[model samples]
Target: MVSARSVAVRARSGNVTRRLLTGLAAAALASATALTPSTAHATPPAHSAAVPAHALTGYWQNFNNGATVQKLKDVDDAYDIIAVAFADATGQPGAVTFSLDPAVGYASADDFKADIKAKQAAGKSVVVSVGGEKGTVSVNDEASAKNFADSINKLMDEYGFNGVDIDLENGLNSTYMAQALKAVHAAHSDVVVTMAPQTVDMQSPQNEYFKTALAIKDFLTVVNMQYYNSGSMNGCDGKVYAQGSVDFLTGLACIQLEGGLDPSQVGIGVPASSRAAGGGYVAPSVVNAALDCLTQGSNCGSFKPSKTYPGLRGAMTWSTNWDASNGNEFAGQVGSHVHALP
Candidate 1:
């Protein structure tokens, strides 16, 4: 089929990990405890910038399944894109207000349309995300995949969505994952198809294959490389996520130079929160640490961006809710990123 909008994906998912990873360093707001309220920050007046198609703008899982329709409305005011995650074995997404009704065999167009309108109202790109570390790759099987693509298209057309993000984690770590993406790309030629692969740790040499997400899709834009910055150093004792920055930055730079991707296509992710010397997993504290460092500048490998990849696209967060009550902290960071871009 002759298509002007479609870009053919030709690369295969390989085990070559030579590049730097990118992603959000924000917190996941799906906690059991009642979230703290965001300390108010003054808005710099609402102004819209003409964001380029290749711009580094995004919305962490700002809204997940079960997100009150009202809650979605609140954060929709800040971000340009919205990410919705899906995994085969995991229960239904519990954070966003919209979802795919297994029984209905379709996505909720009303919410999607509402999202597009909100993005337009705010002057940003609105897209959907599929998959995460725990995301489901099986759903992309041919038959089920066809249903997914069709449903997405129907919803997009019905609602006027701008694009989609393919965050198919796990099983997608292979070349077949790239193939599946090719199929999804064929399904929607014009939508922006983004993939969030782990960061390439050149220093480690143990994870070279993921340097590329099996080389698929037209625009391999925006990588969310959450540093494997785990361990006691990850404790929640009020400190910066300082241990892994050097490696993360070093790896990110490698990706643009060695991996053959434009700098603007990469979005560096830092922990927007902080942890102690022994925190087992990333939590709100880890995100807080990252946010605390925003004043130095947005250019470093830290959660804050002194600027979008001076060489790549821009920055992004891993989730929508965690470190923030709404999206004040993360959105400000995004605003800084968009304005700082060259």
Candidate 2:
């Protein structure tokens, strides 16, 4: 999922060797632990009625990534939420633009819109993701924020996207982003807003990305925290979780669960296959175990939740193209499990 970004050598779950921690890093984690918010009794935020139950979300890159190129219509049935990979930010601040990759021959606008309508008819959500690993979009001012909302709205009008995703990997401004989201929601009352933040981005209650989630929680549909590509991070239980272990998924997810997000608004995101990410790929069984542990309190690791979240939203993967390459194992295996959730 970290295409075009610098990748670090990391320990996989099977060969994880412990490393000595510096005093400063230890101290920082302790401070963050103490400051994290509690959501044991927090209520779910009101959201658009368009939100799906236990969604199997996937990203469909406009360009092919080793797999056969797929149009918005070519997405598999296992996916209920399809996020169109990127809408480019123009040279003008906050202005965004999108075009189907020409390498994959283009279809007529009518054909594209017709396919999107069919997906919606069969109960699928289509959205445009705003940034990627190399994304340069930023909203630093009020005018820029307004431009962000306007451009997204225009894309929604043209392509029939149910909403937009905040996948801005470089940086985000909580104030301006919340403003942009509110403006878009105001224009389209049923816009479905989703977020795909990195592991470190949502570890604490006070992180800017966390603040942005809180700022727009009322209308936020889901926050699919990417659980791969991170080395090791502190879970809510004050223990470090290494990538690829069940503990890593369940523990980090607890931070979001207890940090004021509704169970239905939280989802576990992972690479669909070993080739989909550099160092964080896990089997579909591993993803299922994490989901069961979070929602059913079974198949748990060292850090089990005090209570279960049967209402928890389902899983997401980096891209559908990778799942296709893997013979759709991710969607077939995990999608069945997600649909069976209580």
Which stretches of model 1 miss by more than 4 angstroms?
1-70, 76-78, 86-112, 139-155, 173-175, 200-214, 228-247, 275-309
Alpha-carbon deviation at 124 in model 2, angstroms: 0.4
Candidate 1 structure quality by residue, lDDT tens digits, 218-302? 3344554444433212212223333345423433434443444555444545433332111112333232233223323333243
lDDT of each: 0.38, 0.76
Q: After superposition, how far is residue 115 of candidate 1 from its true place, in Å?
A: 2.8
- Looking at model 2, report the run of 10 residues with the lowest lDDT sum: 9-18
Best by lDDT: 2
Identify the candidate with maximal TM-score.
Answer: 2
Clashing pairs in 2: none
Per-residue lDDT value at 295 in model 1: 24
TM-score of each: 0.56, 0.86
Please provide, for model 2 over 1-342, each residue's C-alpha lDDT reduced to its tens digit, 9 standing for 90 to 100.
233211311111000000112343333223221122111112222222355678888988777556556777777888878888788879889878887777555667677778778888887888888887877789877888878887887888777888888888778898888877766665554678889988888988798788888887766888988888878889988999898999999999999999988887899999877777776788999999999999999999888988888878889987787788888899999999988888
Clash tally, candidates in order = 56, 0
